[model samples]
Target chain A: MLQCSRLSFTYEDASQPSLKEVSCRMGQGRLTVVTGPSGCGKTTLSRVINGLIPELYEGKLEGECLIGGEPTTARPIYRLSEQVGSVFQNPKTQFFTTDVRSELAFPLENTGVQPEAIQERIDQVADLFGITQLLDRDIFSLSGGEKQMIAIASSCMMDPQILVLDEPSGNLDVEAVASLARILGRLKDRGLTMVLIEHRLYYLDGLADDFLVMKDGRLTEHLTPTAMRGLDGPSRQARGLRALNLDANEDASAPASVATEKTPDLLRVRNLTYAYHHDQAPALNVDDLTLSSEDVTGIIGRNGAGKSTFASVLTGLLKPGDRSEISLNGTKQTARERVEDSYMVFQDVNYQLFSETVEGEMLLGARRTDLFREVAQKLDLERLLGRHPNTLSGGEKQRVAIAAAILSGKRLVVLDEPTSGLDLLHMNQVTGMIRYMRSLGVMVIVISHDQEFLAQTCQRFITFRQGRPVRDSRKLGNLLQAL
Target chain B: MRPISIYTRFLLVIFANALIFLTLPTPLVLAINIYFCSFQVIVGRVRKGQAWLLVCLVFALGASLAMVFPENLPGHYLLFLFVGVGRVLPLVLVAAFMMGTTKVSELVYLMRKIHAPQWLVIPVSVLFRFFPTVRHDYAQIRRAMKFRGIAVTTGDMVRHPMRTMEYIYVPLLNNATNVASDLTSAALTRGIGDPGPKTSIQRIVFTRLDALMCALGLVLMGCGAYVAMFQA
Candidate 1:
């Protein structure tokens, strides 16, 4: 369904070509998985097949790319929209409407499809994607997995013969990834060809028909999954889905230290309840929650279940009006006053990055250079001090935000979705930082949807449903059961 | 918090005090305020080395023009036009500084500290988040247009601004709504409206230094007001 012949593309300003003499062909109704290390032009190749090269990104194109026997370069992207649909890496970027139903109807409307046809397609795709219950919900309110699913469903509404997905499940949970794989399997059964560009192969192993490997911007190997697995070498073995040598270890809770006379709890909450004006449900309703100096609390819930809201309230970003009473180190305080005592690394790094340079951002509210040096060394941000915050990659940005929050000298730190866009290496670094925070006797609360992250970084888990803390457990099994 | 640079803070305070004087009710004070403000804004946009010369030349030309043509007929209209320009120019310059230098999150934080109502805080925060996201959306749309081989020529843009608006508006509205929902959920999750004194880790306290600065601002404002009232 897709073919590229000696397709070399060099960016307009760059000194070297992004993709060099890359040649590959993808068969119809088959799933082709493209895997490569970071910065190997995986995204560049996907852009080429989708007619974004030479067209969207200004570049020198030297070769032909054909989609289903038609030269893609000759056809406008709108025309190609009928034959190929693409879902980008970030779901937030691709959406064109507020509600799920309207989002599903967007592409069809652009293509001048009749209203009836559009409605019919929306219904069909919604059913297929199991998003009927989500049709009326605000698009932004949906969880990350839900948003990705909607993005996929919206693309499916175009009824394109081929679907191209760029890291579709990059930020999803394991269950969500499994769900995505199942969806892909069903799509394949319907004879829809797919090209998935991904780094993690946990979910794509059995489903992908063929493996296409690119290294240094060139097509290095193209073979069936079985054939690729038979090859030798550590790189090949890594590509073929051998267990990664990196530690994926979950936190084995330390043997209960000899109980010294317990010091008084440092933080206490009593009858804490909060609800938004528009919400028919409460966001958080916890009765008598307490944390000692050494508690590493993990807050987990479905998206929009108020985990982040709880963190914000605890961190003093949001003030609870009448629904909660919070005593910090035994003193009642307002959100503004609490700001001096608690810090938060927001989910979106952009909000927290207020300065032009990394050093300035890290030292925004910092009092001591010693604290700054400690976090800067740990997060490896000392070298990045001169660079602009926006210039850094996603992982780099996350680290910078973490470093800044830590340097703020807040007694209690809350991290919201800290590992969302991070790779294994960066994720390990952040997990280590969390451990370090706990070792300093600083109370830490992590709000995340990543079960693995929570399992690895935290000792206690709290689950919220409809803004109410329904379960609290130290055991992973109990946490799972509660959720 | 890192102390605001002394020079920048001084400029801000001076500019703010000058703005307050210009906005005062007296006619004479308003006129002088306008005159000086106009000089500041227009001259500010010019490079520093040549700006003084340009300002002097403009001033001389205006004075000469008024002296040569002192007739009642066009002089009143000219005066009115100059005053209008003067009144607008400083406001525009200051607005630019405000928009460019102040981060939206900081503005929201300031508003929250001032105890703004939740309804107001919610919308403002939403707008702040949506601005960047919308800009990103617009960029993506433009890229999509280019990839689709739709030539985004200037002529086409001028002729079909609606088409451009269509591209911008659809995605913006979509993203805004999504962000709003996210904000709502985030707010709700964070217990934003809980009725107790909430504790914050990152406190924006008005330090002794900040108090002293505020006192200096008040004193400056008092002096400006006194000078405007009696010195002239």
Candidate 2:
């Protein structure tokens, strides 16, 4: 069993503690999920459990953490690695090597394991994760979900007694999330304890044994899967939690403001095709398509399905083929013109934020002060206008980027995975923002795997397969049923 | 041929660096470039050889131009500088070959086998993993700049160097800081700080290809030394 008694931690320079009087005990082979809003200490608790708090990040600790009945803080992190394994949120930064086989062997190599033994362990773990075919491939070429699989496999090289996965599904698609759930189920079958920190709760319906709800640096509620299923829509929203069942038909989570009446075609495309290299097939190929400002289109597909490439082409971040043609409202526009009239809020919002302050960022290249204030107030950024853009939380940074896009008066806005790691409250806020953009008559395209978010905002659905738009549906029920 | 040992590749790179300024015979230079070009091809990097071939053509053209033009031509110094860079191209190719083929695991194993200090080994391993992430981060920042109409053109840079620089620098610094901490934490949690002697799953051996390359490197070094001492 893993136990924590009155666990409280404050970072070295912080006046407020991130975790306060938190206590929980998770039984072996049980999957316990911790869900909360951003900055509610789910990550801090993971850090403490993984021995990263006092060792790498200096902080005040007031807690008792026990692993198999022994204090974890008493042992060094390296020593604790034998007992506890950790998989972080970001898949791109956690890996240490370039290839799958080598990355799996890395932890073993560091601990002085024999090559033959390491290879055997690798085979066992690869078979367990059903990733034997991926062993010979390069880690860089794998999709986000595949990378996370390897990350988990590498973390399991030593077969630790417990695994701590912090938002492992943050960067995954719906299919990948299902795959991850299956993998976790297999791990749980092996009697390995797991603590899953996550925001999306639909995928873990049957897998999670218990749900730990946290708020304001405290563990507020502990519920069994049955009790968690009993939560109503309003109560869950009030607690800042995602829907227990996506099929619950929570209309309250959707936008209250309706989209404006259908306008003339806002953007038109013809014969768009792009390939990264001449010798290879095109990554994106579209014969013809037209988008109206009347609908918030949700682009859905598996990883590498050319969803991102389509978005790039629409936003003019990537140049289409020579024969391609794009026009905005009957006006022929070049790539530069498309770029000027469109804005993209990247998934990693940090890259899009450049100015020192949020107010400055909204007006970086924009001169519309009146619109800036209007956008800020709508996105609830008025109180955070003076704070540095990088200093704000993830959701705040995303809102600031959207506000900047609004201030620019762009004809189109594309938000990539806007609610991937956000709680219910923030996801609702983004739904509101998308509605506000539509109310302003700007075309909105959200590239996401979030069915809840999509159902709440998107009126049109575009499904991609192998770089082609195979299915286009206006009925959200069709897409949701297909999923 | 089997994969060559990283040690042999390292020695060949060192030899190329040492003989860069030496005025070797044409046959010797041709031999060195050919061997390295074939090595590149053998490593499945045929595309890389095309670039080196293009560089060689430029160098050949410059040398022929210098021979035909007057000794006191106004732009002769510029030609000299161009040839000077070409003279060191072989060394640059050798380094690139090493980088493209050598795996981080092999490098780490070599360091540990040689009893290198942890301070050096740890940073070198992290640095190898760091470059690709930095490249990705920079690409994202550039895309962001383009989307925001930050003027990523050369003319804009000349007019507003500070603004352009700031636009690129701020996000990069933030990403760098976050990546550094994340990498360090990942490394530590995987028992990288263990005091015990490290081991590796990579099986490294000096094969016949490595021996052949070492012999070739020695012969080139000898030819280079002879030319420097006697021909000059």
Winning candidate number (TM-score): 2
* A-chain TM-score of every model: 0.82, 0.95
Candidate 2 Cα outliers beyond 4 Å, as residue runs: A250-265, A277-282, A367-369, A478-483, B20-34, B63-80, B152-166
DockQ for all models: 0.02, 0.74
lDDT of 2 by residue, A192-245 (tens): 999999999998999999999999899999999999999987788888888768
Alpha-carbon RMSD to native, per candidate: 19.2, 2.7
Best by DockQ: 2
Cα lDDT tens digits for candidate 1, B33-106:
33333323432433431443344345444543544555696887775554444444444444434432334434
Candidate 2 chain A worst ten-residue window by lDDT: A250-259
Give the C-alpha interface root-mean-square deviation per candidate: 22.1, 1.1
